[model samples]
Target chain A: MTTASENFDTVGLKQSIEGTFRFRKWRSIAVPFAILGYLIYVFFAFDVAGLASRARPENAAVLLGDFWSYKTHITRDNRSGDVVASVEGERKGTYPAGEGPEWVAMGETTAISLYGDASVQYLPENTAVINVPDFGEITTQVNARAVVLRLPDGKDIPEWMSVSRNRVSIDQGNWRFSMTPARTEVFRYQAGWELFFFTLDSPFYGKSVGELIALAIWEPRVTAEHSNIVAMIDGFWNNKMWRHGDVFWAMGETVLMAFIGTMGAGMIAFPLAFFAASNFAPAVWLRLTCRRLFDFLRGVDGLIWTVILSRAFGPGPMTGSLAILLTDTGTFGKTFSEALENIDNKQVEGIQSTGANMIQRMRFGVIPQVLPLILSQLLYYFESNTRSATVIGALVGGGIGLLLTQAIITQKDWEEVCYYMILVVLTVMIMDTISGWIRKKFIKG
Target chain B: MTAHTVSGTAEYLALVRRRRLYGAILVALFFVLFASGFTVAEDRNAGGFLDGLHRIFDFPKEIFAEAFTNWQNLPRLFVAAIPSLIETLNIAAIATLFGGLLGMALAFLSTRGLALWPRLTPVFRRIMDTMRAVPEIVIALVLIFLLGVGPVPAMIAIAFHTAGALGKLFSEAAENVDLKPVEGLASVGGNWFQRIWFGVMPQVAPNWSSYALLRFEINIRASAILGFVGAGGLGYDLKTALQWGQGKYDQVVAIFAILFLTIMIVDHLSDRARQRLVKGGALV
Candidate 1:
């Protein structure tokens, strides 16, 4: 009986060992495959580039057109009496007044009308043409703004000429060109073209037609007059389109939506994160449930949420905002939970020894420690959402993105697109700066 | 000491009062803002709660379900994705390899507060800040105008941005290393070059590699989105497919699947490599 039992026991031991090894091997292979499958599912499920491309052909063509537009030049002393100044007509007003003012060298002058009040510095090499159409009163305000005109002397002539904000009609006969230290009055015409100037603009203002033409032909890069501020705003307003009115309205709504959405998601996520943390919740089932919930939420991208929201809500800011809330909630929950899990557990143990209840222990022990990290992360996400708002806005229709998309498709106006893009960029930069400041002030080491 | 006691109670009380006031103000501000949102124009349905839920759920469902079903057209989607993917990878690869070299050089140059000119450190720091402050996508958009649309512009754009990002990451990693070896190398009359090679790099290599790998992963994901504005990538294909709708859905899905799988595999491999390196060091 002893011999038989010993053989049976050996067999059992061998079988168990073999089974364990096989399981381990399979896991090593299976885990990676599972992960790969999950990733693929997430990616395939969330990919929305196809939607963008339908609008892209025209968008791409517009971009290419913007890049490859005509380079204009005029004869210095031709019969047309010195082609005195040029403007690139856009949705906004003229750039580079007729005579130059004394400022840093803003290379190449491209005359493009900006959507809002803008002060761009032009490079000496190029000329920009700003086309302001007949909007009457609005044109006067723009023309009243100071512009520097370049004269033949390679000197800046500062002047404030009254051209129409939309379009100023000019008569070749009654136009008088004069300059002052503060402002230069150029001829006003009723034929839809007027020139203006400021003294503090650039020295390239009043150069001779030949010199101006040479500059335009040889060196053609116009730097923004306010490079620092312009750089910040260039992303939103510059070379971007507002597809429909929806993108425009949506852009504005996105900011509020992102903030509210983040807050809503964050509130829901915080306690859940604590529960999900391994140190705080030792129970396997609780940990698994929390983790799975987080994965499900975060696994999907915001864009996917947007389409879903659009369908349910019939396309609007509410749809966009709600979509943002759901996705951001999942993401914040996952990140916050990870932070909680990584915290030193000894502090919790210390509080426990003092006979504190769960709430008191969490308040005294966990909150103090995790608050800074959490706040900083939240601020960072807020900054990120400002940009995301623009993108998501494009889908559901409403915001600056809508304006941007429309500009691209309808007008194919690269310059106007550029203007809108700059606005978005500036907004994001401002948000980032604000967030950084708050984080510095409030977050502890 | 018993005869002279220093009481900090008053000071502590004043500090507590100040903090409490600030906290109350913050709480009040939050309520005020939330209240304003409540006054916002309501939807026609008036049942704000259910509408919000439906809107939230359906957006993702419609977008994803459509994208998923459309993923059936594998070949066309692959063609679209492949070029963009290659372009994106090329951008990342070139940026990483070159940026890595440039970052290492900058790390050495600015190691001891501007090696070439101590006065220029602040200037370099400002320049780095400005460069990094503008996101890579923004940079590409600007460059697209100046450089014209093509791979070269995209490459340059990525190169410039990554230089700043990787440089910052590398500098921090280098700065945090143990200085004992550095001092030892210096004591032995080793030159600066030798000190960096023998003293600093050895210790920071693992961290540097880890950071670089992490950056590579991020760059891959970022590059996917660069195509939205003509920078060129799989993102472009994805965008096009989405906009065109219906016929191209399968293609879009296929591209996403490919990219998703690629990312997973790459992430796994990188983690394994990182683990091995970390373990090998611990063993050593």
Candidate 2:
């Protein structure tokens, strides 16, 4: 129906349109979808059974702080007729070891205690003979061996609430005691107003059992009245003492590794990049070879590389550093080659016209123009390498991360872990500032 | 006269001699440093490091063959790698979504002559400097303690660090945008946002998208390591296999292949989109 001889002005526009679409049309949609599908397939095919197989690494910091802090015991001494209670390294009021004849102690019948380790301890007594306000107080039968104390409503004490003999001891009271290897027994002891008065001013609140007893023998005033908050603060300070060396060494080692790795990788890749770039290398095979080599290097993650290196080097800083170097070289090489390819060929040609050799052409024609770019690339990679050092340290087992992984799982020492983490963050912040300053000063110039 | 011309040409050639003696000196110094490092490393260690390189070369073929031969044990391998895979994706998603938001916020915040608190340029620069300086891994390691190890902390770490990086690049692109529309908006007394939305954003939007895509590709690689601290991801799978000597090199290779392919495809797409966006503009 159309005239075949008709001149078509749309010819040029049509060819350009078709050409653009040929490369971009189906690709724009299919590529992302294909990637997503591949990711999903990989995800579905992945094995996750080992997610819970390995027991998490223990946090020693948390364990030391939490171990045996919540459970405590109250005991009375039969000979002296004195009674005293200890919870989380702190002792409460003291009474005679046993109940003396014709004496009944009076205080609040109900008492609630908030233990130092963020747990609650309560003693609900049946008799209602003693009463204490705000806190808890109660009185029950005085017996030997182990007797399960009953609540006020005739209910037996909850297992969670049971105070075994191992956790309790009597300072002074009138009572008979039977000794056993396991200290979960109660004794019949009695004490009166004098015992109460003595306990009121005792400094025994925040010392460990051994420390408390030692202090009671040496300095009664200081041992009898310590608080839980102060005890935790003390614990934190003590842990800090042990951590100082590990944290300092780890941070320094990580930073050093990153710096050296970046430098090493940059040096190796600089010359190779010339061959990789099209402008510098006229040989088709050489450019492809260099490009592919660069791809293989950067394609693998540093962590995997670290594992390989560690197995080869036997778990040390050298393996970690090499991992950083190898991984970074691939990345830097790719970028450097790309930059080289983008350089103006005219400059190189100008030098060539002056009968300059290949090396000379590169020195004056290429190096000056790309020097800033190369430095910038190096600086960026250096910043990136600082982070890689941490992961490398964890895998190969050396640095603060060694301590960090152990602390996160074993002890759950969340707070102490917090301290170590703060140090890493601070170190990174400093590195960043320094790198930025250097980049601006040297690279920009 | 002919002799004089030849002598003059020789003098000019010498004057313009391209070899940079200074550059050569610098290169030599670098070589010294490199040599010293290797020497020290070798003395302290042994052939083990070099042997490892040899093993790496031989790993793919040996490992893949073993893995495939015992394909029935694939379930065990899958079980180990699954959680890590989920974690990696989660990190990538979080980083991409939040980083996108942050990039947008920065684009609005930065406009050379129109930014708020012009005096705070150094402050903004310093903050960005700090953020970009701390690598995601470093951030993740620190955060593992604060937030407890899981995927969430790693995601946040990746998002924020990448945001810091992408935001700076976006700001520079925005700064380079055509100022004509801004002038037109200012002439009509339009507010800053109105002017930017109408004038500047259109120009920079495509560049921003391309940059975002590039960052996303990078985030995929970054997220792969989030699991080293028990944050959960593909990195954990790789770490566990390597640690236990599972030798699942085939799986590792497959993953690497996928990741590489993904990045290449994304890059190709971004380039095409950028070219179209820049060229298809309404021309006068």
Local distance difference test, per candidate?
A: 0.56, 0.60
Worst 10 residues of 1 chain A by lDDT: A71-80
Docking model 2 quality class: incorrect
Best by DockQ: 2
lDDT by residue (A15-111, candidate 1, tens digit) is 9999989987998699779756754543343242333433335446535545334211111121212222323222222334343212212224322
**C-alpha lDDT of residue B120 in model 1:** 67
Residue A264 local lDDT, model 2: 83
Model 1 regions more than 4 Å off: A1-265, A282-286, A296-331, A383-441, B1-21, B34-53, B56-87, B105-115, B145-152, B180-194, B263-284
| Stretches > 4 Å off in candidate 2 | A1-245, A345-355, B1-48, B67-90, B110-130, B133-153, B177-196, B228-233, B236-253, B267-284
Q: Which lDDT tens digits does candidate 2 get at residues B165-185?
A: 887888888778778888899
Best by TM-score: 2
Model 2 lDDT tens row, A25-90: 778688779868864654444322332333243433333333222222343333333344432213
Residue A205 of model 1, lDDT score:
38
- Of the true interface contacts, each candidate retains a share of 0.12, 0.21
